[model samples]
Target chain A: MFLNLIRWFRGFVVFEIMGRFPERFINLSTRQGHFVLFSRPRKDNFTAALLLCDYRTIRPIARKSGVRLKVRERHGLPFLLGKYKARCGLLIGLLLFLIITVFMQSFVWTIEFSGLTTISQSTLKEALAEEGVFVGAFKPTLDLSAVQRKIMKNIDEVGWMSVNIIGTKAEVEVKEKELKPHILEANVPCNIKAGMDGLILSMNTKYGKAVVSSGSAVIKGSLLVSAVVENPSGDVSIVHADAKVMAQTQRTKSFVLERKGVFDKPTDEASRYRLRAFWLEFPITATSVKQSYTSRFETKSVFLNNTEMPISVTVEHCSRFSPNIYSLSQSEAQGIFAVEDYLYRLFSLSECESINAQRHYAETDSFYSMDVLYECEEDIAVYENLVVN
Target chain B: MNRKKIKSEQDKQNNSFGFNIKDAFSLKPRIEIFDNTSAVIDGSCGVLEYSETVIRVSLGELSLKLCGRGLTLKCISPTSLIVGGFIKSVEYIM
Candidate 1:
């Protein structure tokens, strides 16, 4: 194989010698320090031989040996190059393709993420990009340990992470931090008291004496469960009081709404689109409307397969609106039904278990005042530390 | 009697010096064949005969005849030659 390669590099030829004495031609060629690779006899004293020498050297040997030499075939790199020298563009294109293939092998092409639940993939990718580790980044310049440390430092929710780079793809594996419940101190001397004024619906005392029974009303800051216990021996000791006290509580809130106000109503809408390439943006449409309008922007980036490029198209929608003074009618303004609707929304927002509301209103010539009374079932137990003397 | 004594003395000197007389002065060819497919001749003079199935190489007083199918001289230098093909037999003719 190595000899064949050398033969190809230094050009070789296969020629046939036709003469009376072909054996003398071979002997003369070999004796003259010329390299003869293989020789085969043809029909009627013509001998074909593969010579590992330049084509120019075979003429003198064939003339001296009194034989006519005809080159049957020419093989090697020089001949191959000479045959394709006319098509210069094709050769240059082939060379460029090989160079580009080798150049592209040194950059990252894809990124894969796994074991992610809470931390977003975009957040991790953004952090990785800040540390110079992203798609299209050179692989040799990246320090995996430093990138891992930077990601961990940037995202506190990650407990442990690993960044693995394989060929043109980078795989990111992460574990999220576990959430732990808060633990309270036990065996402390404390009393459970009412945090708000409420009627006791149910009381479950675990380690204390219940001073207030079910269906009894208690005021705010009043003690419902006591930590002090007196035994038959006339000895008193303080203990931790643990209980769950469900009660019905009343909450009141009041707010006033203006009968006449100015509101903006959308009347006209227009949109403009632009393409963003790198740091420059090119407007695709010439629909720039500069007016008092509310604009909403939607950007869509181009992605080849799963890898994201830095090219995107943004569409901005502009809605032009005018403000007009809107006034309520006399009957609608004086009606208290709107306050009940707002009060129901407020009760739902507060996440009450069960609620009932009563509305009270006072109206003037221009505005109305509304007060809402909300009764809700809620847990009203507040812990108070007991002092021992 | 003098020539015999000198020959005996030369033989004794060669034995004591561990020298081979044939290796020192002989022009005999050394042929090595690998798996009956290729042959390397160390002391080739020139090509005596050329053909597809037979190749005869001259080495001073002796000639080597190689008979095979699809045989060719793979390489040839001033003093050595490599024959490659499906070699069937090799004969050294005096």
Candidate 2:
């Protein structure tokens, strides 16, 4: 039984009280009863004595005790011990596995890079690798400050980089540096003028003449938008007119659009699903196709460990074509208008008070083409100060 | 009876052993053993005339040399020496 206990401990079932066994005690099993007594004694002659006697033949040491002794008396091992030992093999296996898993998790398994533009991913990965923060390196060993310094030293384009350990994955958030724009500080004479039309609420004539007062009316190209002016008191001051003048005005714009559509392109291919470990490999054997394609294949690639591996699978899809021609449907034309509007806003073109748009011309030379005319008008300042004070 | 001869024998025993060659001259002195012998004077067999190199030996090896002083065997190697610093010169005992 003791040997079995030692074996269970060796298999890591019981770990806490392994080394606490008494050295001078021996437990023996006999036909009479189980004996647990000291194997060493204080006398110098005989080392110790360990014996067992039948319960009926030997007198009870505590005959006056109220408690009755039974052959299989409860030993009061903590109730949890038996429960723990019942499934010790599985519990111990799971516990050991959990410990090993935790050990592995404390180290880095993947290093994900985020917010990288202008600089290539491979270049950033290489820069990070030089700082000892690459894949498979221990996460605890990473000194983020040192890595930041090293990255800044190696790549001048990187303004700052933040490193964070999310469980077993290391995330490197990068921000490419912004370069200061060059400012022309020449001594050439220049001017500033009213940039927009609004009621001049406030004005300070710093180095230029105030052509229009707070309530004065100024036309779009009126002299109130001063090109050059003379101050009072006959000092002949050549003011730069480096002051803002605002007044209310109006604007108008127009656009002409002409469009056509031929046969709608046939289905190129049906969307398919392919399972891969790292999105690097795709084959048609496992991927199911539902339709056909009438267009050429376009290959898309994804990067893994600095290698650009193709992940796209192509299969030709086509449908029988009918000799048919068509015009732009209202929905398609509205979609185009939405896209045009979005592009116009994105390009920062001025808002139009009016639009004069028309279909200028259209042609069908292999593909449909359209010519659009857009016209616009707005109240803009014409007279700008061209002299410095 | 042979009292006079016994007396002479006793007298000889009272003095040091005849093998004690400490008072005798050594053809190769201690200075010669330690000196750079890449240069040797003319008429010296298998020896050089002039060189600046110095020979070195460890303390343990020197102790071995001191212990071999009483042995009547000489080493003839260029890089090794056997000093028979005791009575009489070495002879081929074999």
Candidate 3:
């Protein structure tokens, strides 16, 4: 194999000598410091052999030996090139394609970001693009550590990030920051005042003196706990007032429901299509209808041999919906249930201790009123800075 | 007696160099046969006769005839030739 490679590199010719005493020709050639490989007799006097020499050297030898050397085959790079010399454009194109392929392999063709929840992919991609770490960017020019530092500094939500460039794909993995819960501290001297008018159910004072006991009916903004205290020797001191006061409160609300209303109903009409391309998107199907529609998009990237490529396909499902007018009669409207739902919403909106009793009064055929008595617990302290006069 | 004495004096003079004159200058051909199937002859002059069963190569003062079945000249250079086949015998003729 090694000898054949050398022979192919230097270029050789396999020819046959058809003349008188071809054996003499071979002898003369070998005797004059020429290489004759695989020399065998053909028909009567004709001998076929492979000469491991240039054609220029063999021409003179064949002429001097008075033998006709017909080249039956030529093998080597130069001979092969000469044979395809007429189609030079095709050769150049093939060479150019190889060069372009090697050059394109040095760029990032696909960028994939994972482990993102609160932070959007587009925002991270934009940040990466600013650092010269996006698709079509040169791989060697990207400083991953610098890019990571820049992303961590620019995006406050990002806690950690890792940028890994494998071949033509860039994989960015990230973790987001977790938010801590807020805690409110009472450090200033203040009085605990009534947040609403209610009958006091219970009072538990951690600090300061309780001025109002249980079963005391107080108005809004009335002090329930005092921050100032007096000793037996006429000495006074101010302390931060802290207490939990449970109270019973009353609430009344009215809700009116109409006999008819308009509602949007989803129909079974939906259109789905796919778009596929490399680094560019071209929708293969027509656009969905211009009506109001809710759409869902799913994208899948193409990978060849476990390596992600720039080509991807996106499928879109668009569902159109129209409004439907629904009506209900007086008896079928279920006004009590609607009022109860409204009361539940109102109670959820306000902080309360507990509801004691609920009463509903039907004022008219279309009007319904509800009265809810709630037992609540709240902090009613208000602070006024000490006026030094 | 004169010729034998002259040849003995020449042999003594040649051995004075501590090596055989033909081996020191590589003036003689070296033939190596392997299991009667392949033969390599170095310092060959040229081909004398070539056929399917016999190949005669000239090596200066001596000639080597390779007798084999389906004999072929695998390689031939200026001073060496490699013959491969089912070789039967190699005869040296002066």
lDDT of 2 at A106: 60
Clashing residue pairs for model 1: A37-B73
lDDT of each: 0.81, 0.44, 0.76
Task: For candidate 2, write residues A82-141 as lDDT tens digits.
Answer: 657877898789889999878776666567888888889889888877787765567778
lDDT by residue for model 1 (A111-212), tens: 789999988899898998899887678889999999898778878998889999887778899998897776554678999999999999999998778999
What lDDT, from 0 to 1, does candidate 1 have? 0.81
Candidate 3 pairs with clashing backbones: A193-A380, A353-A376, A354-A375
Docking class of 2: incorrect
Question: What DockQ score does model 3 reach against the true complex?
Answer: 0.50
**If scored against the real structure, what TM-score would every candidate get?**
0.62, 0.38, 0.63
Candidate 1: lDDT of B21? 65
Could you give candidate 3's per-residue lDDT for residues B9-87 as a string of tens digits?
A: 7787577666567675766788888888899999998888777888999999999999878888888887888999999
Model 1 over residues B1-94: C-alpha lDDT tens digits?
9999998877875855688665656677888999999999889888778677888988889999999987777777778888888999999899
The candidate, 2 or 3, that scores higher on lDDT is: 3
Candidate DockQ scores, in order: 0.44, 0.00, 0.50
- In terms of lDDT, the poorest run of 10 residues in model 2 chain A is A13-22
| Distance from true location, Cα of A114 in model 2, Å | 9.3
Cα lDDT of model 3 by residue, A1-389, tens digit? 99888878777787777776565677777777666766775445444545345455766777777888887877887788888899999899999999999998898898888899999999999999999987678888889999999999999999999999987789999998887766434556777888778788888888778999999998888888888877779988877777888777665544455456688777655556665543456877776665567777888878888766777778776766678886656554456545565567566635654444454534445443344443445434444433335
Better of 1 and 2 by TM-score: 1
